[model samples]
Target: MSAPSSRSPVIDTVKGLACMAIVWHHLAFYGPMSDIAQPLAPGLMAFLYDYARMAVQVFLVVGGYLAAASLAPAGTARFAHAGSAIGKRFVRLMVPCAVALVFTVVVSALVRTWMNHPSVPEAPTLAQLVANALMLQDLLGEDALSAGVWYVAIDFQLFSLSVLAWAWVRALPGRWPQQQRAALARGLIVAGAAASLWFFNRVAGLDMWALYFLGAYGLGMLAYWAVQSSRPHGWLAAIVLLGGVALALDFRGRIAVALVAALGLALAQRMQQTHSAGRTLPGWADGLARVGQMSYSVFLVHFGACLLVNAVVGTLWPASAPINALGMVLAFALSLVAGRWMYLRVEQHVPSWATALRWQAGLVGTGLLVALLSNGV
Candidate 1:
């Protein structure tokens, strides 16, 4: 195995934890809000779990950070090349998203057909499927295949915004001053958050499709690239952490989220300072790293597993809070297994094969294989 770096392994661990928390959240899929509102199992477990959605801010923040760092090298003159950075990023997220979209179309349609809801509200199809396959559902304001899929749009838009922000900083290096780009990020995050709060409170419910999520992502990216790096002067990190929690508790969502994202990225930077590659056998972390590698697939495939499992179990056995919890546990276990399988078989193996296949039969064979797999299967 390649020696694990300071950032990647820790980020992988965080991803694993985030994905697991997401699974727990989705367990409430089939039930009413009252089901969750009436719980306090395992002491404060319910409260902790309920609030864990807050951690997704870390994922968005870290994602932005990594993407920004990748774009901006620590060199002399000129900003990083934008075209190359964006192209590489597009492939990294897009390939798996495409695979997930195709997989969702095939499976959701089958499930809907199986549940005898062939004409039900949530039934899947080829054209609607194509739109999702292209990640344009959110663009067109159409429905989403899954709840979490909207994040794809958020990630894409934030990516463009991050690039623009980077360019803006490069252009106005004077206004940004020395290494205090954190101020710029802080300013953008506050403005975006304020606007988002206004939009959410005054206009309607949580609009993930609106630019708020994108703004959060942009703020996250800005922090990732501009600030939230480098060791603090002193206990500034501790101060930030405390202040973040205080503001969040005071019912400030945007600032709290930005702070949390900053905290996670900053924490990662701090950890990197103390990082050592004790390249012994990887422990519980190895399993978690594998989960991180497959996190995209897990995030994609998990909801299907949960929906199918719940549909089957709820039909055979009456559904309740306890039943929902048990089903969620089972869904997580099954999703992990399935996700790992996809990572190893489809994702990991295909890249090495792509090169060889390109050299041999070239574009003709590649197109044929793509056509066969996408349409034939």
Candidate 2:
């Protein structure tokens, strides 16, 4: 019998987990693990630093795939069509960002109040907020407006790039059928991904700026194109692409491991939908949908929580690596709880709150801009 049709909560759970991983990494790396997770810490800590964030690349790649798949149907978004997708993304990201910025400011403010320490910087100005409002903060050499603005900024930049690429493809042979166009697009995307990695490590010294937003997003686009195309070959292509990344970058084994884990999860989800397991997955699907829903918020706020926890831990615990490691554990516990709270309250308000205010979670777009303006950058 065909595998029961199933829904994939795995993806959503992965997103949620990835956010937590980032949180732990930041907390451990900056706060305690240097001493704690280092010699005292296990190899897993090292593995995460080396490879876990690459899992984030998986998210980006998948997003790119799904986006391209959607675009395959519509071809591409025009200026008008682009507005809503871009706008919604903006809202989703900015809301949690705003909340984090406010939370950070409050924390910063409290520190100043208690310590009377003039050493800490004040909140950012209106001009800075304006820049962040347009998602220009990161591009302008500003520190992340909060902590995780990179993900949103990069994703948006990639989305824009994808649209442009699609436009260019459309202009060429201007009448090629979708199949041929998709194949060409996939080839181009792979080439671009390779070029992106090469240029980043070799040319830009692995600087984030030199990397192509499209390349990362394009990875997903390419995958989606393959999975949805006549050949429908996602699994093998992902392995090949990741292999290229490994060989070219001299990636440690952790990255390869992350790639497999992520791909397996993606495939499992796909199988649940397409196979006989489909019925076994609706609950997971619904749950994942919820997790996916809160992903943007978690991504934005998790790091800041880490920072705060790191600071407090450093202030209270041993400054040495071992002591800092303890702090990281504490931070993880705190951030996990705090992250969930922010998602539930700040990012994921109840239906009543949403309906009562007649708000569509859209206010977060403006709110984040305000926080950015309020924070120094």
Which candidate wins on TM-score? 2
**Would you list the clashing residue pairs of candidate 1?**
65-224
Compared with the true structure, model 2 gives a TM-score of 0.70
Instruction: Please give, for residues 230-297, the per-residue lDDT of candidate 1 as tens digits.
Output: 54443244335434444544555644665665656556655654766565327888777667767767
- What RMSD does each model have against the real structure? 7.1, 6.7
RMSD of 1: 7.1
Give the least accurate 10-residue stretch of model 2, judged by summed lDDT. 1-10
> Tens digit of lDDT per residue, candidate 2, span 39-58?
67568677656655655665
- The lDDT per prediction is 0.53, 0.54
Off by over 4 Å in 2: 1-7, 32-51, 73-80, 112-128, 171-176, 205-213, 233-246, 249-266, 279-293, 311-327, 345-377
* TM-score quality measure for candidate 1: 0.68
